[model samples]
Target chain A: MSENIKNWLLFILTVAVVILLSYLANSIINRKAESQFAYTPQIEIGAHEPRNVVWGKNFPRQYESFMRTRDTSFATYLNGSKLRDALGEDPRLVVLWAGYGFSKDYNQPRGHAYAIEDIHNTLRTGGPTGPGTGPMPSTCWTCKSPDVPRTMAEKGIGEFYKGKWADKGSEVVNPIGCADCHNPETMSLQISRPALVEAYENMGKDIKDATHQEMRSLVCAQCHVEYYFDKNIAGQEGVPYLTFPWKYGTTVEDMEKYYDQMEFADWTHPLSKAPMLKAQHPGYELFTTGVHSQRGVSCADCHMPYQSEGGQKFTDHHIRSPLDNVANSCQVCHREESGALINDVFQRQKKIKQTQLSLEELLIRAHIEAQKAWQLGATEAQMKSILMDIRHAQWRWDYSVASHGGTFHSPVEASRIVSTATEIAQEARVKLARLLGQLGFSGEVAYPDISTKAKAQAFIGLDMDKLNDEKETFLKDLVPVWKKEAAEREAQMPIRPVSSRE
Target chain B: MRFSSLKKKLLPPPQWRRPVIILLGIGAGLAIYIAHIANVGSYLTDDPTACVNCHVMTPQFITWRHSSHREVATCNDCHVPQDNFIKKYFFKAKDGLYHSTIFTLRKEPQAIVMHEAGQEAVQSNCIRCHISQVTDPRTAAGVSNHAENRLDRTCWSCHRNVPHGRERSLSSVGFHLEPLPVATRKGSFVPAWLDAQVNHTSN
Candidate 1:
């Protein structure tokens, strides 16, 4: 070959090789990008698709891992996915929450998988055959199911919360799942509960503008946080509107101030005649004050870390206590030994428990003292301030204790809340003693004999037999119909297996 | 002049230099690859004997030794899954590559987060062996499976607080002191030394 021809041929050959290598690299990169975003609609996911198995066909990894919430073996010091009967374990709770539905039956929360089953089994829902008749309002099912969003979408949000708990039993069959916190089209974490969005609007904040990192914990916050059904909300009256008291703030004092200003009380205390307030679980709120949260650690960071399977990674949706997986949870943030980290949790828990027990005793005594004052013909005017103190005090106490995992989860904040409650309760008792003296009785009123759970239940006048009978009747008559209807409806839905191209 | 002559001889002509350099480079790469495959690098799995490795798992190892689950299980038994042959193998390979890379780069995170999926994998294995076995319907077990009543709660549902049953009971063989005391240097070795002394004295 001529020298010039040889040079030109070599140049052409080099350019061809370069082009081939670049094309190969680009193809590999594109395939990888495709793998991450390779979602194809294998089965039609309806708007009301509540069954996770159906969703699993389209998103196998998330679905398979979400099913793991059914595993109940994992236990921690204070919280886990396992079923624990709080009343059976500590019956003092029954008396403390006398004249309330929770006193009838209360259990430590299990995984989200059992939300529907646990609610069905609970005695609080009571027996009802007709609309607007059950013991619990339709708002009770708001946090328990993905069916909630579907119903809220079908019926207007206000209309959905307008009926009784049993009115929509069949309609709300699916437990909390992917739909509750995820948008099917995007698979992005989205708030499905209207209550959360409305609460944000009330505070002049837009939840849509939340950061991606915030969404990790915000998904669980949809259900786990405290809320109350406001019956007197203007223009929304009689709707039993689910509202968060975050207008003022989320702190115990802030919520108490808001309730006090509105002269709101959950119920007149059966024993003390004090205006009482019930504190729902404030897990997310208390969690935010912890060192972990301050360091930008989210609920999902510890509770739902990422897992790898078949060379692909996805978020694990088995949300529960982190202690069960310390290596994955705390060890990721703190280099402490697993045993040492567990001990850290236990130590905080034990110290807080000591004060919490003390606060409970003091509050119990305060209730009895207030009752004695009322018994002595103390005027309502005279008891008003004491009642308010009792109200605020017990609210604080309940806020700390009822916020499951609060002590170990946020020990410092939990301790402060309990201490403040103890102070207010002690002040209430002091006023009660003076009121009793003015009524011509001075010595300490003999405390009720509530050493055991049975004694406490009797003390509180809870007809357990009658309650259990009603529950049995409801389960026998109503639950079966709900389940049958749900099964019939689900069976009619479409489910298609993956097509074989081979 | 001698040095210049030596440099010229070592350098070789331009054409010869390229071939020589390429051949030497390929030979060096093959030798290193063989060495790596043969595990000839000073890679230390046990850092106690090889201080240069500085194993990052001492705390975990100690905690595992003291754990109640330690006797019945190992670290891998609870943390790794036994399902999906492909996935299991992938996990081992990925973890191996990751550890190797991190060791090479010296940039591993101080604390590793074990994913919820990993814990679930462990949990499945736990439930597999510990399935409920009480066949009799009459007994009032912690979790009874009464066919007549249709009340069949799982074993862990009620017995959730019983994992450290032996430690709580304290009557078992391996009951250590509560709120474990810091081991003194003398205290730790006293048992070993006493055993040796007793053997020597007896001999």
Candidate 2:
């Protein structure tokens, strides 16, 4: 080749490379700008802002999505945003919880938007006409709203958990919102609740070192996980403080060991007279054992996936079942057809449900047989081991069932838990049968007619009519007043406009 | 018309031109060959292929490939420090020596874990990238987070999946790379620059 031709080619090549470099640089700058949107604040959001309507002005997309939690149209095979009376579906729950408040009523929670409303409606919270009147402690308000953090910060964490459920009625009006899991100033995921922080401290772990991705799940863990009212916290005695029993560890057996060591009992079964343990929803603990969590999927990854609106991307706040929006939740990683994925979840759930039902049947029979033994004048010594078995079996049953979505979150673990409970229940029934035979009672101590929720409640000796009447009056009289007082307080803390200040 | 006349008056002498071109050709050829042999191109991009550059990392790579993080992050984004280039490469070299020595000695257990230094790197990187999450003014005094013990725990204490899947083992992952029930295990070691050569549509 000629030297002149070679020189020309080199010059052309250099110019081409220069052009490519500039294009690449321009795109890099553009991409950076794209990711970091020019976030012009409309208002200065306070660190403890509880009213989501105030936060809504700053982030319309997220607020809008959060507001979508109000939608009750969606339903899955078992549960969803839609309301389904849990006791109606499964009357056995009433008999299982016999002496507990859950026997009065058990309604499936609608969604986050109805947190405050649902608490007022549910019979479990009981009918309190005013402060210091309800069966539950003020700690029950811990997970219902952003108002909880605000009240806790304002009137000390311990003080916030000091009284009855009605004590903070007027103070905490807002439902679960932005502030419950976010630092309003930075909009970063923050642990607003003291219980989760205290729980971590008890376990010799710190919450601050949790990564953003971990925070995604941990925020939900704050409310969704199993917790108990510890009336024996040092220096804060008799407060019924909301506390996670993770001191021993997070496993069902580990928590059982902790409760057993402490000799804690939620309530004594009236018929069987066995000390019982009620399992609160342990969604986070069960979820941790699942395959998705092990592979680094956060709660938000599935429940609140990143959604794009127009040109902007934000985490969808309308948290509900993955089945409701299979395209966003399941199809994000799963290449399988949506139907197949839904079927897979349903299949696991159905199999777990089968074992759960078997355990419940065994438990009911054991409880009735124990009652017959008591009627036959059996001594406490005779029934001690049998009651312990009942307690153990019921704990396993409640643990398996109370871990919401246990079947899908970690199917093998959920199924394992239920099967173990079945075995325990069977063991309890076998003991009960032996005890009954010795007490001069014969085969099959006539199972109580608990076919319907009403029948179950009646058998359990719960006057639903009186309970409903009291709840109705409280809702009609006190709830409106609570709303009014909350409104007056919120009105005083108006959001200051940033642009208007200038 | 402009460059040829200007080159004649200025620039390199004709005798030196051939040697310069020859040297440039050999240098380019040698650089490309080294990069090809060392798989250096894979290191530059956010591909999992660079992770399995050593055979010991194959299990880790496969698990990560199937992870939800498979889309958002590369190996270095979590496993290496992100503060500055000097510190990053420095940390990498130091950590690499320890890693190479261990793997060379076949010291990795069935379950691989991050060393203290690696853990520090990962924790700092997590906070660095997730600055928005950790930048809570409420935690300024650390009073809310129990003051002295704020950073005593690491992210992976709860987030085991960030390192690798808890269930998957070296023996569990086969060489065939077939689709598994856990994760699809769909990814490649090919760098973005050479993507066209392999028709690499997926990242």
- What is the alpha-carbon lDDT for the whole of candidate 1? 0.69
Give the alpha carbon lDDT tens digit for every residue of A338-412 in model 2: 999999998998888888888898999888888889999999999998898899889988988887787899998
Question: What are the C-alpha RMSDs, in order, of all predicted structures?
Answer: 20.2, 18.9
The parts of candidate 1 lying over 4 Å away from their true place are A1-41, A496-502, B1-203
Question: TM-score of predicted model 1?
Answer: 0.66
Query: Can you list the residue pairs that collide in candidate 2?
Result: none
Return the clash pairs for model 1, or none: A328-B114
Tell me the interface RMSD of every candidate, in Å. Answer: 29.6, 22.3
lDDT (C-alpha) at residue A432 in model 2: 80
Model 2 regions more than 4 Å off: A1-37, A500-502, B1-203
Q: Return the TM-score for candidate 2, rounded to 2 decimals.
A: 0.69
